[model samples]
Target chain A: MHSFESLSKDFAAFFQKSHFPDQPASLYQPADYFLGLGGKRVRPVCCLMGNELFDEILPDTWQVATAIELFHNFTLIHDDIMDKAPLRRGMATVHSRYGEPTALLAGDVMLVVAYDYLNKVRSEHFHRIIQLFNRTAREVCEGQQLDMNFEKSETVSLDAYIKMIELKTSVLLAASLKLGAILGGAGEGNLHHIYEFGRNLGIAFQVQDDYLDAFGDPDKFGKQVGGDIMANKKTFLLIKALESADPALKAELDALLQSNHPDKVEKVLAIFRACGVDEWAKTLKDQYLSAAFQHLDDIAVLSKRKEPLRSLANFLVQRDY
Target chain B: MHSFESLSKDFAAFFQKSHFPDQPASLYQPADYFLGLGGKRVRPVCCLMGNELFDEILPDTWQVATAIELFHNFTLIHDDIMDKAPLRRGMATVHSRYGEPTALLAGDVMLVVAYDYLNKVRSEHFHRIIQLFNRTAREVCEGQQLDMNFEKSETVSLDAYIKMIELKTSVLLAASLKLGAILGGAGEGNLHHIYEFGRNLGIAFQVQDDYLDAFGDPDKFGKQVGGDIMANKKTFLLIKALESADPALKAELDALLQSNHPDKVEKVLAIFRACGVDEWAKTLKDQYLSAAFQHLDDIAVLSKRKEPLRSLANFLVQRDY
Candidate 1:
């Protein structure tokens, strides 16, 4: 079985072929620019891992991986516009670099190109793969709408937030694995286990991401500590703090959220610590990680064949960053 | 053979079922709302007509028809946002009424739903249908981008404008017909003829639309006369006039385009008439309509089976409006 790192390199080499045409440079160039601003390529790698876990990876798996990556970037471009975000991965976002109109079109064409890639995949399960993709794509949009709704809302339940994260962040990851597995000729029973594995691993990774943003060493984490706190962005820690804090501490946390004080991050961190949110976040991450491992264990594959996915999951959630 | 009017009614009835879920009303509601604002279901009905031309309409044709309509509406929602159009079908555009962010998501989910519908079709040629849809979708995006680019450009050539219109308007219509024909067990040759028929018909219809906007009575046209001229929108007549007019007339047209004078429409109309653009538009429309009919005649189907499409084409381009 191929390791994540090896497969990632393979996917990168394969993806270097441009997905868009040269003309209408205004529409396609921004899409190319954003795709060029590479991330970890985790989702596409997850697709490859998903396939490898079931069987020798088929040629169609790479196409599915490429589709997943393109779809992810499409969401990011549109989400950045909706969020009015200026920067992504420390570079100007598509909307901020190109105009909003062009960015919107760019996101659109990326999605179209992603489907074109999917259409190129020749698999017995092509129809099912497409159905899962459509459902997941719709859910992601719903998740974005719900996230935007939460910004305007005064209160959001933990269940609601978790649902949003699953829809926004987890399902695509889960779907990627399932897509690959589908192409790999995985049986229905194995498909369920791998999908659950991805879903839980994704949630655990997100929890770790939130925890690191607030508390990890900035040098190690590769981001400014407590940046979410400074932005008054709601994360798992803040939500837990609000739910678990004593009345006085809750009032203080609310006040901190209202102000842009110089010490706001420090103050919020203190409150999070006081309410045991930082510790709770770690425990939550561990619980989801354990559930993920349980699902991975339940898969019908030999334990040896599952090693790459297991290692990748560990790397994703165990990282300080 | 189904008349366009009958097929249109069938499409409307079939489309009465809501395309989205109730949860996250923010995302789905705008999409539903946009679809509710009725326009002529031209493209979807064309699908039905195309199917009927080859054989009795199949069950899959309705699904393809639904997909085409949803895809068309998706483009309209996003285009309305890009154009900053406040009104559509005499009501607030999706972005203006629901907000840009929601509107963007709405358009996205509508597209996802469109794919979902397409996935429902049980066709032997399913893969080819998807490929066609994907190609057309990408071309439409490129077309929109080109249209936006032209708005900022100092001058746009007639060929460039025609290409834009073909991409933006004609291809979808052609694809709709082709999609239906594909499902109705059309041989390859008939598919080409029908697609070309739709393409030329679409161009002719657009020419008529441009002409009606400039010279038709407002009461008959159901829109303000010369609305395109007032907005300084580049159209076939405007481009043709500029190309054909003497230097003095071209200067007058240029100055009028630069200003929002109360009589700008009248002045431009005068220049257009002086340049014989009004008469020229009629000849151009006939040229395209004849080409469309020629292709229709080339289809292997009985000539009687071609009546509905021929009549629809004539109705589309020959109407005063």
Candidate 2:
């Protein structure tokens, strides 16, 4: 199996070779800018890994990887607009640099372009790939809607938050792997198993993101460690804290959450520790990671062939930054 | 062949039967509202007409029609955001009512849903339909980008303006017809011919719109007659006047175009008449209409079977409002 770095290098080289039409600078320029901006390109790497698991990487795998990457970037462009974000990948966002209209158009064009690539797939794989892509795309939209809905919502359940993250972030990863598997000629059982592995790994990664937001060392996290707590985002930690705390502590936690205290992050951390929310999150993350590995193991492939994916899941779940 | 009214009625009824998922009101509700605040539903009607032309109306015709209609509404939602328009179909624009973020999300989901319906076609027709849809969709985006570019540009030629509108508006109509024809089992020759028919008819309709904006009776036009002139829009009339005027007349027209004169409409109309731009517009509209009819004539279908589409084209070109 190819190393993740090598697979990503191949994906980047393929991407560098890809060309966008140059006219109508308003539309394609922003698309080009956003795509050119650096990202981890995790989804495409996952897709490549999935393809390599069952067979030698096929020609169609690159097209599927390209489609997945374009679709991911398309979502980011629009999400930045919705989030009113000023910077993405340490650069001005599409909506911020280009106006919202053009950014919107860029994202729209990117989506159409993604389908353009997906349509290049062999006819034998066309129907399943498109159906999965359409379903996953719709779920992403639904997830975004739910996230927005939660902003106005006064109370949110841990289950609801998990579901939202699953829809928003996890499904695409799962779909990417499944698409690669399909193109790699994996059978139905293997396809489902690999998809579950991706989905579980995604959920585990998100939980790790939440846990690290509050507890990760500032030097290693690559972002402000307590940013989520500061913003009072409804992350897994807060949700679990809210769910598990007794009435008095719950009220105290709520006050700390809503307060403008300078030490608000410290206070929130204290409460999270007191309620064992940190431990709960750790346990949940491990459970999901274990579930991901089990799904990976269940695939009817050689143990040696699964090494790359297993290592990938370990890296994703165990990452510090 | 069925009358356009009957086909439209069936189309509308199919639309009424359509259901969008109700949860996450922030996303789906705006889509519901925008779609419910109806336009003429012209694209879907055209699609149905295309399907009816060569073969009996197939079940997939309605699905394609729904997809076209949904896609049209999606574009309108985003276009209204870019145009900053206050109303659509005599109702508040989606962004104005739902906020830009929600409206943006609504458009995104609508696009995904469009594919959900599109993916339902038999796999035999899937590749061709999706390819055509992707190409047309990208052209629409490019056209929108060019349109936005024109907003910043001071000297847009008539050719550029026509091409912009063709990409922004005409190709979708053309694609609508072609999609229906393909679903109706059209030969490639007939498909291309019908698409060309729609394309020419769309351009002719837009030119007629520009012409009527300057010259039609206020009572009959159903909109402010001089709205385009007042807004300094580079309509066909203005482009022609700019092109055809002598040096002195051109200087005068340029001054008139730039001034915020209360009688700007009258002044521009006078200049348009002096330069024979009205006649020019009429001639161009006729040429396009004639070209549209030629494509319709070239279709291998019987002339009697083509009558409904022919009448629809005539109705589109001749409408006073």
Which stretch of 10 consecutive residues in model 2 chain B shows the poorest summed lDDT?
Answer: B17-26
Model 1 TM-score, 2 decimals = 0.98
lDDT of 2 by residue, A269-310 (tens): 999999998888889998998899899999999999998888
Off by over 4 Å in 2: A246-253, A256-259, A319-321, B246-260, B319-321
- Report the lDDT tens digits of candidate 2 across residue range B39-89: 788899998889889788888878878888888888999999989998987
Q: For candidate 1, lDDT tens digit of each residue in B135-210?
A: 9999999999999998998888999999999999999999999998998889999999999998998898889999
Model 1's lDDT to the true fold? Answer: 0.90
Residue A70's lDDT in candidate 1: 93
- On residues A1-321, what C-alpha lDDT tens digit does candidate 1 reach at each position? 988899889888988878999998888889999999988898999999898887788888888899899999999999999999999999999999989999999999899888988988888888898999999999999999999998898888888888999999999999999998888889999999999999998899889989999999888899988888887777888888888999999999999899989999989999999999988998999999999999999999889999999889988888333
Compare the candidates by lDDT and give the number of the best one: 1
Provide the TM-score for each candidate, comma-separated: 0.98, 0.95
- Which candidate achieves the best TM-score against the true structure? 1
